[model samples]
Target: MAQSNKYQTGDQVKVRVDSPSHHYRTPTYIQGKTGVVVAICGRYRNPESLGHGGDGMPEQLLYRVSFAQNSVWDRYRGPSGDKILVDIYEHWLDPVGV
Candidate 1:
């Protein structure tokens, strides 16, 4: 069965600001940051579960999220238009307005 995506391209989202004691793939720097969904990267087995010797089941939806350099860093010296793309799981994101 195919999983339905919760977000679409251009949708505004914010990375969940969580610190789990277990293994996770979401970067610490991107946590709590707001970004726009750029693309749906499809589903994959959850790595956090796999890291603990458990079967990675119920694949998670992944998306390409874009964040402006200026917004991600306080002293970013790059162009204001510069942006970074991060592959994030759906569990690590929340809809901006919801």
Candidate 2:
């Protein structure tokens, strides 16, 4: 049987700063940013492994996180409520304290 999702919708989480010296899917700009899990995109084969021609296995949970533009950028000059949604994996997330 498949495992249940570790996070739920509306869960506050922080993206971990895992700067592996290899092909990665998470964008550098979103690293260390805090956001809310808006949706769970299910699981899929690990892409980082497939990037280097390895057989992608052990699928991971993907989540749609929404982050306020201002919260993500220190010098953000856009709309106050503008947000960016990103698809992130389970391993890249850290639960934020209430």
Candidate 3:
């Protein structure tokens, strides 16, 4: 497992989609969106199945990510509402470039 930079609560970050295995908290809609790292949720064992449930799996680290409603949807007619928070794994993030 790769060591993750210890992210403090409310640290802003950008998350990228690597691959959608079987189960992950990263929603398909936000795969390539830039968001803030809201909280560190600790490490979790990867639960992706290799079509047979026993191969090509790696341990994963989890984090809570938050994104503005306006940042996610262009035509979101609904009130911008509160930002959405997602529990994302480490493999799903990359540092955002300014």
Candidate 4:
């Protein structure tokens, strides 16, 4: 089955973990944190692991997730004015409906 390409930057999304045991690009602290989308980097079949052979679809949408610095770090010395950005795959996101 083909997935629909319907996501946009600035969209609110929730990152869900499909695998608990495997290491992921998403930090564990931000797994359940809600963030806003910053950018879209197209689609790819593989995750960004230098060791993992790149093999998958060419249509995976990549997105930049932005979270507040205070939300991610416990002892962040930076002012609340700062934020963090993480590049994640689209599969990690879902519509954040409260």
Q: Estimated TM-score per prediction?
A: 0.96, 0.92, 0.71, 0.73
The lDDT for every candidate, in the order shown, is 0.93, 0.92, 0.72, 0.73
Candidate 2 — which residues are off by over 4 angstroms?
none
> Compared with the true structure, what per-residue lDDT tens digits does model 1 show for residues 1-98?
86578999999999999889999999999999999999998898899999999788878999999999899999999999999999999999999987
RMSD of each: 0.8, 1.2, 3.5, 3.4
Residue-wise C-alpha lDDT for candidate 2, range 1-98, written one tens digit per residue: 67999899999999999889878888999999999999999898888888888887788899999999999998999998999999999989999995
lDDT score for residue 68 of model 1: 96
Kindly give the number of clashing pairs for every candidate: 0, 0, 0, 3
| Pairs of colliding residues, candidate 4 | 43-60, 44-60, 45-57
Better of 3 and 4 by TM-score: 4
Using TM-score as the measure, the top candidate is 1
Q: Give the TM-score of candidate 3.
A: 0.71
Over 4 Å off in model 4, which ranges? 1-4, 18-23, 48-54
Clashing pairs in 2: none
